[model samples]
Target: MDVTPLSLARVHFLASLGFFALFLAIALALAWVLLLFKIQARRTGAPGWTAAYRLWVRLFALAFVLALAACVPLLFQLGALWPILMERVGNVLGPLLGFAVVTVFVLKSCFLGVMLFGQRRVSDLAHTLSVGMVAAGLLLATFWLAAMVSWTHAPAGAVLVDGRYVLLDWVEAVFNPAMPWLFASLVLASALTGAFLLVGVSAWQALQRPPADAERMAFRVGLRLAGVALALQVAAATGAAQWIAQAQPAKAAAAAGYWHGGETARWVLFGWPDAAGQRNRAEMALGRLPDWWLGRSAEGGQLGLDAYSGMLPPVAATFWSFRIMVLAGLAMIVLAGLTLLRLHRRRLDPAGLPRAWLHGLSAGTWLGGLALLAGWGYMELGRQPYAVYATVTVTEAAGDIPAGLLAGSLAAHLALYGLLFAAFVRMTYHAARYGVVPVRKAGARP
Candidate 1:
């Protein structure tokens, strides 16, 4: 099992991406929670909502800090592991990234501090506006990242000029073919991630000995939030799936396990992708769904591996990531449906929903993260063997990549991120347990 420099670069790059995604999801989730808290306070005027608002403000600040810290390394990885990407198109992407730095790093970070430190200095209305702005910044950041990554998968805005890739149209680069679909999916995913965190934490709070009523309110809010988000996720998932099917058919073929040539391709739950054979070694096939679902009809739009001639990305990674993402999605839909049913039946009252239901949500809290990670892996891995689709192969663009340095960097990152994760979990647990900041000097104008 010899690991080449290419493999080392890939592993380190993937690790960096995974670590960054986790923290980013946390930050986005916390931002959404703040916004939800603001809306809840406006609607109910309840002390419970106020307490929830204060509690979430503390958690969001912690998440924002960790996410920013994790991102710093990823910027380094781009140059260290994928120098080709930076050298070739740095100019084109530099401005796009600048937008996120300003919107998210500067604007979001400033407002976040105002919310955390300026509590007494700012009015309640001003505090709410601050949190809302933070949420907006998160959304903008998500969009910018998604669009940039989507461009790598299916580049649209640049051309190879002389020996370098040059930016021809900023519009085309920013609004790549895969950008809108990916952006839609990620937006729903952020909400889903937030809902799950709320459900997990609030459910734990509700199960405390003697279970406070405010905790019960938070639990109900969590479930309802998840339900509403799940409904929207269905629409988003559909668009994303269709976009993948059409824009990247080779990836879609791998995903659906449709290796054999046919108009009606069978969907596989799991299998070994035999790239050399151009087929799945062992498959559990569910027929025609990918074709019909994508509105491709009987003619499956050349889903077989044989359809493509050039270098194809690894099939197994694409296949399994897609499978895992879809399974996670199904699990979320079930949870959401059950939540909605309870609401409609009037069973979700202040007396507190069943212990079993709370426990169920707590148990499944990681599903949103699983779905998001798997979907990201599917999207990214399916474009592999190339740093940029059709333009740069991993080998061609590596640019004297240092295997030893990458391995060292990967180890250091894992250690640092592990510490960060432990700290975050501990901080959040204490925050949830203690429950909410005190509403200080409510009548003061200053």
Candidate 2:
């Protein structure tokens, strides 16, 4: 019955919130990729791609359903878990939340209905518009959501009026310093995640020898999308990390595992960061290159967590997650590089790609998904202890909800999602193996 400060209970609640966010991230990427598929189909007029589009329509529906499940809980968690943050800053964040929800419903839901089931009912141009509008809606919705997250990490354009946070400049708040960098990284990450998933699934199908023809088309689309996104993701990531260093130094420091305040910095190739001791163990370091890449000035200066004023997030999670995300990114680039080589050699036609290359892409799929999840966790965790960095600690924001209730809710959510995930995988496998058209029209057999 009693409210508590930060506790294990609080961590559990936060984990559930994060768990939901992961699904949303994947769903958003799927929506974007659907748009890409529609565009490609329209441009190329390839029969292979047309079949692939049908397959993706079914897959997109599954992702959309899962996203809806997560959306309800995540929206409630904001107010339920962080009463102070919602109540005090309600005036500012309320509008953002409303706008995001409206964008999702108006832009995504309405068009998505037709995109999934109206291909035959609607004109070709109308169907394409449906896909494009759904993607646009998702992008705009994500913009609002990302703006909220960016502001959480770096509170901007809000002023304390009457002892409550008030939105002085709504435009400034929406386009905060972190928003642009985070937004760019997020959009790219989504595309990469979706592409990698398609790459993996389609590659698996292709490995089946006879191969589903649609699988071949999906593989080609996935390969090109993942290859191109990998190249762009590097630039987006570098920019985001660099900007994070300037704007949220504590997070940047924790990510690099630099606990001691100093100038000469080493880029850790791998190590375990021990925050209590203020150093890394089993460390391999590139002595100067990391600073050269990350720093703005010619002197190449970097600050450790000690140099930062705010309390650091759990050093170990930030360090490992950041490294994992970076390593995943590098691995994707390598696989993508091989893809380009095959393309140049004419060995990567949709009709036939190298077996080894398909396997590599299948493996590469995990890397992109891991990168998206880990990078998100790294930032969200790095912004931790505080709901609004410098303004509201999570301990201060969490409500009086019972620990048992929170734990129970977390377990139920996880179990349900597990079942849903299994179903989705099974359905996607069916689509990949037999194709959606056969399944949908199976009942129509005379």
Candidate 3:
């Protein structure tokens, strides 16, 4: 079966888009968790067995349900990708992949059911169990996805037998050579995205009015969490760069505007790709950087490995992506920290620093969000010609699907997702501003 490059390119585009969509869904779910934690903290003074507690618990349960629903599509889409896997792995590996998906689905369903119904009977244990279960499910899903991605880059671990591909060593195949770096990168991304949400939410909350002591305390905690997450993001980006240098030198080079021929390459910081030389040349040029900036050895040698078996490219693109993600993350962390500091100083209530800090925080939050989005785009697009599981060229995998069908489906998806995104933003905004149920004065006994 001869697969053309165009088909593979289409597949690459769709898969990247799918991954981004999944990330956004997970991010939304996490935002709900952050909100729930805040509500729990605020309800601390309420009677242990009050209606308010019950209401909050019920709300959390509902949020859990929504999260589970969001994940269902993602799981199904992953399973749908099996045909392509089968093409590469033969029939045997395809079934193995399917089995993993089934296992994940069953586990997720059981956990979701437990979270929804077990709360009343289990009481305090319910929350703990729910969190643990969800976390485990998420981790497992990440691992499975990462393993599949690893297979794309290195297909040698499996061999065709009896017209079917069987993974010689399932463990080794699943945990391919690139697993560590990819996992590290994913961990960092999750932390970074999570931190951004926390800081953004806290900042928006604080800006409305002078934070109460409890609110201020929550803000402080959020700041610390964001800071730690930022640090880890930086580390993860570094590891990712190293891995790319070793395993995907060609892609790394393209991203960095360094090709075999010394033809002038342009860089692309923004805007979609253009047809002519404009976008390409601009990207190649903009993407280029000084050798030392990417880390030169003592003898001024390139620090990153070459794309060819023996020579390394400049590592320009990876370096830029790292900087963008880090800079944005740090900026957000600072804004969150300052907001907390203002509250702590007792200067937050009536005026001075709090207002200015709030403004900065809001702007910084949005800016960081944009940067994160861009960084993600760079990471995915840098691999261009190759889909995430580098084994399937973009053109071969997606060409068979009719363009009209894909377009129609995409339109429907966008409409629904747009509505969902808008509703989520509106609800979150209203909740932050007016959702807090006023507590009775501390000493007033009911």
Candidate 4:
């Protein structure tokens, strides 16, 4: 297979994005979890709660560091691989990116230290306030970033003139129609990912040794959070899907493997999308329920990918990515439900739950992260051939660079990310296995 510079650049950017996304999801989700832990610690004055807060705060720090590190490449890649894109949408994207950066720097610089190390130096109220601030900052920063991405897809509040985007309405541009759905999806996905991280880590710790109070608390909290978030995510995803179908029917059709679009209620649950044939091989579908639930998008028109010739996204990639994401989400919900049921029955303690079940929960450590990645792939791949949705073609925006150089950089990035990920896993394992060690006074003996 031959690869062009554009393809290499795309893959390199995607690798950077994927790493940043995984860590960012962890940081976003854990920020709230850390706040909850601190609140519980303050309310109950329990050592277990404090211990949980202490232990998880370290993990949060690691995730934040990696997230920040991973983001650096993406920023540079915009100029390095797609300078034309910046030239085109710079006016619209500049403010959003600036706000997100400022939010992170201000919030993290001011309160992150307090949340991390000043807990002992400051009053309980002050420390709790710091944690809350950090969480709020992460959410705010995410909003700006999500807004930037959504604008690229929907291009609202802006008009394209002379090959450039000119902002008309800041408010509409900031809160574009796609922005809210994207924000909601991202936030919920992060929360769900964090919830499962808690569940998986706690379960692993329990299996390795006698369950501690902190471990039990983490397990129960994770289970409940996962259950609630999963349900909310399902609803949000359904609504988001409908929105996408209405807004970008071609994308929706490719993702769902819809070949012939008409006034039909049939929903393809699974299929192999054959782009050449313009049909789904071995299709499985719900005849009427999907249309009832999601509504038939009349705007989608009678033709599917056929109508979007020369502009349609890769069909199989979109179709399979969507299915993978759905499968992972459903699996998570089932696991959470069953685990909660078992706990409610009081047949076994957190550690005493069936070994198979515990193993399954433990194995789910990366499931949320992977599922979120798939969801991203489905969304992004569906918007293929466009650097700024319909306005700019990716080929037009791609930078002039040798294929060899791009390929070399891609390889280097993959290696570096792999090493970083391995380090994170190893460090996390040691931290969870041994537990947090309390700080002692000066000259105190171990």
Candidate 5:
């Protein structure tokens, strides 16, 4: 297989998007967690709650800054790599992206300063509201971005004239069938990402020193919130899958590594897709699981990759990424549930817990983040061969860029992203261990 400029550009775009997305998700989650901490601080007037708020605000600020910085490359890549995408869907995508940008700018310029710096100058209620508004802005911005992506997968309220897509109804297009499920799943995933980070950091802090009130509170809340979010994710993921299956059956079939359509589809436990032979080379699957899961029978219809020969996505990539995502999600659910149960049995005593359990929790901090990245990989790769589903092929949208130029830029992006991630981990670890810095000395007068 030849490595074309288009492939290199896609790799570069994916790398940039992944880096931006992880920080974006973390920032969104941390904003809400900060709000909770602020509310608790004001209500109880406890130093512990205040300490927690101060500690997490630093992480939130770090995430927000990185997310913002990482987004610049993606914005440029849209024009550099797939310039025709805008020409084709600019009527619909331009406004959606503009809305997202406006929300982000307004919140960052207005409320972020208040949330981070105005805690001392503003009233308690005013500061709390700022934090809440920041979270709302993040959420609103996420919805618009998600709406644009979802519309590409299932282009609703739009019609093609000659080649360009023209919008028909705003409500139907923005709130398409796939938008709700994708947005809901993303929010739940973000919550899990933040919750696990909180749990892991709090647990690590306990292991380093005796548990403080702030650590105990953070640990308990993180555990409970993770459990609740995982519970809700079950339905959100299922709904998303069912909708995708209906909207893009070829992508769904590729995820399952199904080559031949049948009423009773196999739920692949493990498999290697052989596109050349049009079958799975070393497949291991539960043949009846799909029937049970989807409520299908012999009379029901199922589509597979065979139905869309030249239009199929990369089978192995989709299949394995989906599997990784599901496996990661299940592992997190089990870990969270088990930890919660043990804590409950021990009467919520961290002192009674084994060090090994804490180590496991610490090591599992990235599981939620891993699941999120893998799920995104599956979603994006599953839409392959086309930039906008069946409407426009990627090759059609790809700009006339030289392969050498794309390769050099891709390398630079990877190097920078690696350094950024390393700095984030190192600084975060240092802060979690040492605690937040005070604005003034303990004996200083206001």
Candidate 6:
């Protein structure tokens, strides 16, 4: 495939999305650890745990800083491609887009500064306030990014009058197309990831030489919370699927392996999507199945869907991604629920329940990761054929990027990120295993 600046931008955008997910995962994991430490301190009356909790909180804050930094370059990259995007959008929404971009950069920089230096001040109240500010800034940054994404697919709140742009429907544009399901899916995934980390860490703690009761309790509570989060994830995925079916029929059908005619396509259990063929040919065909069983077109007849209405396809890709997300979500919920149940019954022995629960949580974490990736793949790939907005064809967007540069950059990023990931794992393991509470010297701050 030929590479253009636009194609490069698209590749970078996808890479940023991957980095965003990984960073979010790391942040969630850190947050979970911090919360667990705080809870343990409160429950066990351990003053040392308070210090540990604070340290972890600082670490979590640092991760957020790193995440923001990692995302900043993407904004610049997007800005470079803004000219193309503006041309595609007919230049009407340019100012709004510019405003959003500027606001995000400013907010990100402010937060980064605060996170980097605010802790140096010894005042507890000042430190707390600074942290809160950072959090609020991050939220604003997220909103700005989300608004940009939402606007691209569904432009609203603006009008073109005789060649000039007029901002008439700001509110409409802000909430255009109503992407509640997509937003909910992202938030739910974050929560589920956090809960899964909590459970996994607690279980690992419980498996240490002498079983820690605090760790066991944490594990149980984490399991319960994870179950709840997973249930919410399932519901969110279902809603998202329904939304796609209503808004983007072709993508949804692709995801569900559904195509025209009464042949009744069956969902693939596992297989790579054949983009050229416009189908997800299963490694092992399950044969034609009823639409009702697939929770789509049970009554048949296009389900009265207008596939062209949405920017994405309403069929195959969207449908399959939703199913994958739901299945993984449900599995997590079930496993977590069972772990919670066993704990409640006092049958969660260290050797049996804790180890089993850890394994289950790990599986759920990996599955959730896969589901998230698949969902994103569906969103991007299903929107293919048109690379820049739905109106701009992929061929048109391909600009001046060399194949070698793109390939080399991707390889470098993968290697660097892989090393960082391994280091993170090692740090986490060491912290969990050998970093127990240390004794404070006399007259020192406890």
- Each prediction's TM-score against the native? 0.91, 0.89, 0.69, 0.94, 0.95, 0.75
The clash number for model 5 is 0
Q: Is candidate 1 or candidate 2 better by lDDT?
A: 1
Pairs of colliding residues, candidate 2: none
Q: Candidate 4: global Cα-lDDT?
A: 0.84
Candidate 2 overall Cα lDDT vs. reference? 0.73
Worst 10 residues of 4 by lDDT: 289-298
Question: By summed lDDT, which 10 consecutive residues of candidate 5 come out lowest?
Answer: 289-298
In order, what lDDT does every prediction score? 0.74, 0.73, 0.50, 0.84, 0.86, 0.56
Error of 2 at 116 (Å): 1.7
Per-residue accuracy of model 4 over 17-113 as CA lDDT, tens digit each: 8888889999999999989988998889888888888788999999999998887899999888999999899999998999999999998789999
Candidate 1 lDDT over 130-192, as tens digits, reads 888888788788888887788877778788876467888989898888888888787777677
Candidate of highest TM-score? 5
Query: Top model by lDDT, which number?
Result: 5
RMSD of each: 3.0, 3.6, 6.9, 2.4, 2.2, 5.2
Model 3 score (lDDT): 0.50
Q: What is the lDDT of residue 131 in candidate 4?
A: 94
Candidate scoring better on TM-score of 3 and 5: 5
Report the lDDT tens digits of candidate 6 across residue range 332-359.
7677777766666664544456466665
Instruction: Kindly report which residue stretches of model 1 are placed more than 4 angstroms away from their true locations once superposed.
Output: 292-301, 347-352, 436-439, 442-446
Error of 1 at 227 (Å): 1.8
